[model samples]
Target: GRALGEDYEVRAAATAEEGLAAVEADPEAVDLVLLDIRMPGRDGFWLLDRLREGFPNLPVVMVTAYGDTETAIEAMKRGAYDYLVKPFDVAHVRALIEAARKQRALTRSAVSLEPDAPSPGDRIIGNSPAMVEVYKRIGQIAATTLPCLITGETGTGKELVARALVQYGPRAEKPFLVVDCAAIPKDLLESELFGYEEGAFTGARKGGKLGKFELAHGGTLFLDEIAEIPLALQSKLLRVLQDGTFQRVGGTEEIRADVRVIAATCADLEARVAAGAFRADLFYRINVGRIHLPPLRERRGDIPALVRYFVQKHGAAVGRPVTGVSEDLLRALQARPWPGNVRELENEIRRLLASTRGEVLAAEIPPACPGEDAACGELRSLAARALEEGGEGAFHRFVARAEASLIAEALERTGGNVSAAARLLGITRLTLRKKAEEYGIRVPDPDA
Candidate 1:
């Protein structure tokens, strides 16, 4: 308590029963709990359950001896906020307390979908018909432990839906862990998910580490970019989903973890299966409870609400507190095709807030395509002339010319950055490069 300084008021309890009683008596007064696992009478686990039942939002950090880190980890899987090993650094404890406080606050805030509602923290913030359908699906399956698969275009809030599932489910009190399969290298992903025994391979730790599966036992595990999981690893994942059992890499013992798995992907798994890149059976297993999120372009009616939410959220964040958005600004936002969806809209809001000077946000809306304002007139004239000439391949030729022009403009806008241009053009970098080459357009070296 002294180590945490005068900023925190510490309350100590002699026994597990006494601690639970104190919290039950005045739950609102307590922000954090540090319980020793070996407390006399009823044990920490018993007290942990009592605490969870009463105050699922409260953060509890388990205290353990040097060799009991595994038990501490087990405690975390079973709803403890974190653990402190004996003789732990005072600074580390302080950091853990701070983090737990922040997370607890966020969990308690909950996600709100009220249109144009001002929130000081995180909220879902959409009320269009498509978004309403999305919410309905979330409400329907969030309470069940069904294996859920969230499919959407990138930046369409797939992870947000996944978190909502964890928040509303019976395992809300337990740990919620996320793994991005695409971010991890393919070679290491197997061991990353399943763990490995000591001496399993070169440079293995003396005490084999626990994998996310074991760590997330009795809770939720969110696997983003699910389609990126390699074919060989798919079978192992299928086994766990089938029987809730898996062995550590290179280990004989079969370990079991009761985890609710939620997966998200932007890729079309049906195409992957057709191409023989993904297993058909595995796809069907995860597809049992699927939720597809509509892209932002399909739900432009929700743009005002989204813009309002982002303005309030990012305005204070950027230290430029604008009173409100202009009608002109809102219309301009709704006019563009947000290829990157909500994520892109939020980024643009942040960019505007960084340089915004006035009380009301009003800025020039750039053309969707660079130089589009200047070229639209000429393009219309060309189209009319092509129609008058009535050539057999005129339509195809016009489309090719327009596509080439857009590709060149996107590249120019991004200063020859192929990846950025591809994102702007709503196509893959590979496709952009092929089109650029076919059109005899030169792009700067990627390394440059």
Candidate 2:
């Protein structure tokens, strides 16, 4: 009410089931939700899953403690619009609410006309600031025929973004051609891009095949590994960009080039130019609109969403039904450095889906284990969040989660030796066994 006064009236729900039922009864009545992560019986994360089921596009912001980055990321991965930390600033809250409201309105507008109206590019899953910036750029350049240069590390989704720009724009109905500059030999790169006349060379086709540029006329052409274009061919590409005209190899006629160009490079073009490998002039031409995709490590927050996406995509391929991933596997995934970026993460998820028959991915052993301090980190974060939301109010669930994690870790470290694990915990064997049972800790077989 403070933000929009009469226009916005908040209807509060004290519990998860209450909120779920209210939304289920009349989801249209609520424009947004501010859900606390540490509710009794069911936490904010639980409600997020339920809400997504009933209203996939409804904006639900997880209200977390100030430093619960893990929870915030998990919430977003579960399809929350954004998250708000405790001690919320009125201005920031208002801004998030307004943004979510607008986005929800837009989605509803589009979905009303066509139930499956989401464009391929709009489905680029991520909530990290870096991926958010990438999405913004995709929206900014989607409508125009601008020369866009996308720079990123290999497998960082440069080609995906280029396709999104075309998929979500006015040119979506037109042809989209892709040329891998590094894949083709330097000798054939020119002929491959601008085509050639019949009998232009010893092995030329009798009827002459059209180049990527001609085939992509009036649409968009993606040049992958753009920095690999040989110096001799750079001038020809520049001519096409400058005057929208290019001649077929060994032909006198100049063809009108009505294609929009999007170039991607994992290499450093400026450095390539300095080393006299890439043309500085051509670099500037394609740099009209630029997008730099961040490596996966920089945007680890997106791992959950990417995992969810890949699970949904590849699960049905092998006829498996995957509901979601386990917290252990998800945490382990986030711990990885992902040197190969999104591509590596995608492949890993695909592998898990193919290997596992269960609904949860944690059934498959994690690729990496999180640090020993992972529980401590979570404990401190939850404590701080609890204090901010309710001073001196002890959150038993937080303590329980920390205990469960510790017990599980100890059992794993002890090789299922009850006496050894009890000694390591400084507790009696019976207490250790009971705690392990309570936390559902499985002691792996030492021999097996």
Candidate 3:
């Protein structure tokens, strides 16, 4: 304890039983533990296994003179913070303890403050019934290796869901490789994924490059915009999924990857399959489990929590001390439909922090998007009429129809190009498409 620094407080336990007692008595009192693998009566492995069930967060550093690679790997698998070969340097032990403390601090900070609400790290932020269901589904599926297909609008945090699954699941320590199918060039994506040998293609790196599958072995491989992957490559990806075997672009030697595939897309994949733009077989392979992130407008109840999260995150990033958001500003925020979802909200917060000074955030509030403001106004008008008309369903249908018609007309004017229509309507393409589909309106063809 004294060797490290005055900042650390250490307690030594004589026996495994006593150590377990001490830990159970006051879980928060201990920071790092030096557990000997060969202890009297109950061995270190047994103790380690028991401690994991009760205090998984506690950092246990194993100490053994007869340690082997298998023992080290097993300790890690059993959640040992780190292992020390016996007669190890005092400084090394101190360093490992310090690192464990830092990791624990980060984990604690990620939990949300509100006791009743789900913590930020628990799942995606939202309180709607749909969101609650999503969280439940995530918990149920996190333990399995089944492929998950995340479907949502562009800014609806599909990647966030994927990351959360990896972070909170069994393969948390393993690699989490992301392949942006839409961003990478079609010609080079295959090589990037399956890797290439020195002579596989022109300008190939010497030796052989490890593909994403190899890099993400025994972990997750997230394929974002999976629908954008070229049809020819889809067959290759399918073969890997079927046999977990693939050869480098130029090499004939087969390599097996034990990876969990999580694919995501913003496109209507079923429609794309019908159009022959995507492989129907690949779709079925990756769709064993699915999670659809609802667009922000559909779950406006989450706006407050999301806004607070972004404000705090960006405020710290920009070195500003931000006070709580104003009630009027929050009302305005909740009133506006966030087309870009969590991502757009984060960007807006960064912009606010960059432009404004002082603790109060009202001064940094940007003008509401024109479409959102208009929608809010119409809702208010409808609400007033509904109050007067004794809450008639006809009025509700009328408002819904009007909103749908307005969106459909805007999409039509843009020639069914969802992105262009989103730009024209001052909304996100994800939000626009969702609204269009909800209203049963035909999405215009870009060619037309």
Q: Which candidate is the best by lDDT?
A: 1
TM-scores for every predicted model: 0.58, 0.58, 0.58
In the range 289-351, model 1's lDDT, one tens digit per residue, is 888998787899878877777787777776655777889889999987776677778878888
Which digits, one per residue and each the tens of the lDDT, describe model 2 over residues 1-448?
A: 4555555788778899998988888877888888888888898888998887767667788887755667767877887777777777887777666656655544443233221233332345666657655654665567578899999876688888888778666788999999977556678999999999999999999988789899998899999988667677898999999999999998999799799999998766775564344678999999999999988878898788777767766666768567778998888889876656777688788778778877777755454335534344335444543343343425754465456545555655665577877788788877876765554344434357
Tens digits of per-residue lDDT for model 3, 271-355: 6664445678899999998999887778887777777777765566667577667777677777666655666666676787777
State in Å the error of residue 161, model 1.
0.2
| Residue 144 in candidate 1, Cα distance off native in Å | 0.8
Task: Give the C-alpha miss distance for residue 71 in model 3, angstroms.
Answer: 51
Q: After superposition, how far is residue 59 of candidate 1 from its true place, in Å?
A: 34
Span of ten consecutive residues with least summed lDDT in model 3 = 114-123
Model 3 local distance difference test score:
0.72
Show model 1 residue runs off by greater than 4 Å. 1-120, 370-448
After aligning candidate 2 to the native by TM-score, how far in Å is the CA of 139 from where it should be?
1.6
Against the true structure, what is every candidate's RMSD? Answer: 19.0, 21.4, 15.5
